[model samples]
Target: MARNVNYGALICCLFVTSIFLGIFVLVPVLVALFAYPSSPSFSIDLFDNQALNMTRTDDSPTNLTIHFDLKLKNENKAIGLHYPDPQIITFSYFPNVSLLTILAEYKLDGFYQGNGKTRHVQGMVVATGFPTVLEGTDMIAFWVDLVGSYKYKKDRTKMHRVELGCLVGIDYISSKKMQSGFIGLVEPGLDSKLKKKPSPDYGYP
Candidate 1:
């Protein structure tokens, strides 16, 4: 009789342990396997100092041609991104504390980005109508907005739209024609709803 009782207790303990493992360990692993990956990262690079200088010919408006490299990195460990063709990029300038003026729009050819990989896309845009406030200023700040749709390589049937934005400011000395590199912070997250305007904390006054 004592031997049978001991066997019954052992069976009960095993059942309880199995339940605990299922609730604590197996459940999370399964949830992670099906969840979406982390959002991708983005940055911009301005290699040429002259890219920011405005030029004019005859009666033509002040032409500001900017050459930049847009960098996109997939942060996922196992998932990849499929960006559709013709991504739209908008360049704008601030005429005042509350006014944003559109300068130019450029379209970039899209491609695939593998997990844990980065891609540098070369882009250029010719913008006119620079605000008088930029004249003789030591620093100029502008807004860069990117809008595109992408699909997960793991699930290509569904396409998701993403909007990314950042503010780039450069300092220059008009006497020497020298300029500092571009610096800005790309907003976090993967959609337009997650984007926030630059505040005083980000050097936007």
Candidate 2:
């Protein structure tokens, strides 16, 4: 009789443990899977790569104009996206192995995007006082960083910010001109630290 009582107590303890585990672990997992929104896709297109060139002379600064299109897509099925005004787009060059130099920067205007929709933002950035010398290199690499804040349609109370970055190498046929054509867009890597950072005050509720 005592053996049977011990067995029944053990079964009760196991059942209670299972209930607590489901409430604490399984419930949150299900909520996260259904509530979290998907990340958007980002890409950049260089319109005139030939514009990327260096000017000769020390007194006269080089003015490098880069015309490009930034493509942003909302991949979420039901949730819309609200981008804040004046998105920051930076163009940088790696003059050496470790150093990164900013050549140009442009403020892109923000807009709303429906679910599964893509936006093509056309803009240009002129780099003045450019210090890089591209005379000896056949190809030069540039890094693009995009930083912006956004909010989902369902969750307007919380704002989420993200940074997308990519690198592209331009091949120069001459010191003054780059190979003519549209440079293929490279998919940027999303910053992993995006979730940990605090959201900015956008005055949105």
Candidate 3:
């Protein structure tokens, strides 16, 4: 005689297992997909500058700064962020000839954000180095950029990642005020020659 196979019991066991997996694993992934975190927003004000101006005095090496207010907002009501050590923040200088490669100018600082709250982080990236002047001119033109990458946990449940980037530009390195009173070597009637080639600025204010 063949033993009876309990098909009803096997079906019930499968249904129970599926329910547990759905509740424990699949639900969290779905929530993370919908309630994802937003990229960090930044609004910065340079210390002792009227606007986003880059300046160097006659004697001092060019002081490059990346300090500004950095903010992160958690869009997920259930997600919280954990910022561990070894956060990488860099401020680098791009030459006029090539803006791709850079000489690192300053260090960027990183921080953490809470659920439904905006985290405010502040620091100053000061780089003191002699700037190279452009050929046939007493002025220097270079670009400054800031990049930050951070690792965080989702609702303290799992890990996720995000990044932040910004660009800064040095219009001119002269203390001499133009006739318009801007911080550059903009002399009257010589505007065409003094003007450098146009470059894309990312509104890094």
Candidate 4:
């Protein structure tokens, strides 16, 4: 009887151990799958008007506040964004005066501020490292000020089309997989268009 009892107990222990091992291995796969699982499509939304007041009267430094309603959903989960680092938000404007592509970058930290505000953030971007999660929902509102400028196409004299947009990445492979959302257009202005110049090969960064 004693020997039989020992054998039974051994079987029970093995069963339990197998179950535990299976769970442990499965957990990591589940977490990784959550990180960036496959899906039919993903999208982000931008509000109609600019949230914070943007002033570019002088070249000292200007803050361009942007308010956005961002949402992301996958096959099984919804994700929210929390940016601890500087995320790049790009604006492309073709002025009626310049024939060059005028690109502006706004770096920012974002949050969900109320009163139609996601959070009281400061910078030219809403947030970085977006879609930080796989199954959650968050309301994000932030601002971006024109802190500085970089010449993308140079020749700031010819007329061209100006469109506002952004550049985003996921899975650490930036530029390669970028999420760009079109915001608006820039009418005839100082930084009108791209000069007769050759633009960079790919729109990544």
Candidate 5:
């Protein structure tokens, strides 16, 4: 007597396995990439539109400490972001219209953002090391760009960026007197200080 091979049962089993894998593995990867991450509004405690606000400029100097508050929203409904410690946040400034110059930088620890949830990442970016000579240009326009990077898990592996980049535009009255006053304010170790600051524990509040 020969053994009976149930073709219908085997087909059903294979079909069920494929569906399970698609729902668990393949589908999630697609959703993660599709949903991605994004920052709707990036607010800092140092600007009024494009002008530097006077809230923390009591020292009458050109450079100031800006408290950055950025909202990171995970669009996926199934994935979470796994941010590591001391993620890099770079700041570049363009004093001249087209001459982009590297400026200061800082870093902050990462936080986990659940699916469809918004988390805040805060850091202090110092506006320093500006050249004293401004070529007597009044109302000089400045362009500042911020690049933030960290690891996020949308799938089995991690991802790098959520969107293109974060940018800020500044157009203010560049007074010679103001620049002259801040000539010697920032010492030689300003950059080191910005880089060596204690890492922030950006955990959930």
Candidate 6:
């Protein structure tokens, strides 16, 4: 009889141990598996120019800044800065937007130039106003500064459609704590180096 009682107790203990394990371990795993995947992205569009300035480049091109105020939509669902996904942000400008500057300068007149006339731009953006959750009806305001170098030449016309395109990495490092936006040019600027009777200082002979 004692042996029978001991066997029954062992069976009960084993069953209770399994139940506790399932509740503490397996259940949490299932929850995490279901909740780890999230969708985090937003849309953006160009608005009007805020401020822009132009100058003649010498041996070394000076860093000029062209400011613009942009409008974003559907920002209520924007994920944290650190999210793993490539977001597409583009900037479409009108004619005569040739002015360029650093995306963000730690010091005054500091910028980076890559390749011929391109620069690797990076900066932080903010969202303003109340956004309609899941409705894609959010309004975002932003100003972007394009930083690069340009050479000053005379009697030359620089006119064409400038398209600037970039991919924003929301979380390049943490995959949960960073966000980025890309910009592209839809219509470029058009200007010339004094076509008729070029200036003696800058006009080409």
Scored by lDDT, the top model is 2
- Pitting candidate 4 against candidate 5, the one with the higher TM-score is 5
Off by over 4 Å in 2: 1-34, 48-61, 131-137, 174-205
Model 4 C-alpha lDDT per residue in residues 32-144, reported as the tens digit of each score:
55554332122233333343222223462333323443332223333323222343444332222233232344454433211111232222343222221112212121211
lDDT of 3 by residue, 15-117 (tens): 9999998899978887775565554344333232335444545765454444444444555555555555334434433344433323333443445666667
Better of 3 and 5 by lDDT: 5
What's the residue-level lDDT of 26 in candidate 4? Answer: 87
Q: Which window of ten consecutive residues has the lowest lDDT sum in model 3?
A: 181-190
lDDT of each: 0.63, 0.65, 0.45, 0.32, 0.46, 0.28
List where candidate 1 sits over 4 angstroms from the true fold: 1-34, 47-61, 134-138, 172-185, 188-205
Summing lDDT over every window of 10 consecutive residues in candidate 2, give the lowest-scoring window: 193-202
Off by over 4 Å in 5: 1-59, 130-155, 161-164, 174-205
For candidate 6, give the lDDT of residue 184. 38
Clash pairs (backbone) in predicted model 3: none
Model 2: per-residue Cα lDDT over 111-153, one tens digit each: 8899779888787877643545334566565667777788887
Q: What is the TM-score of each candidate against the true structure?
A: 0.62, 0.61, 0.46, 0.27, 0.47, 0.22
RMSD of 2: 11.8
Query: What order do you get sorting by TM-score, best first?
Result: 1, 2, 5, 3, 4, 6
Q: Which sequence of candidate numbers ranks them by lDDT, best first?
A: 2, 1, 5, 3, 4, 6
Q: Candidate 1: what lDDT?
A: 0.63
What is the Cα-based TM-score of model 5?
Answer: 0.47
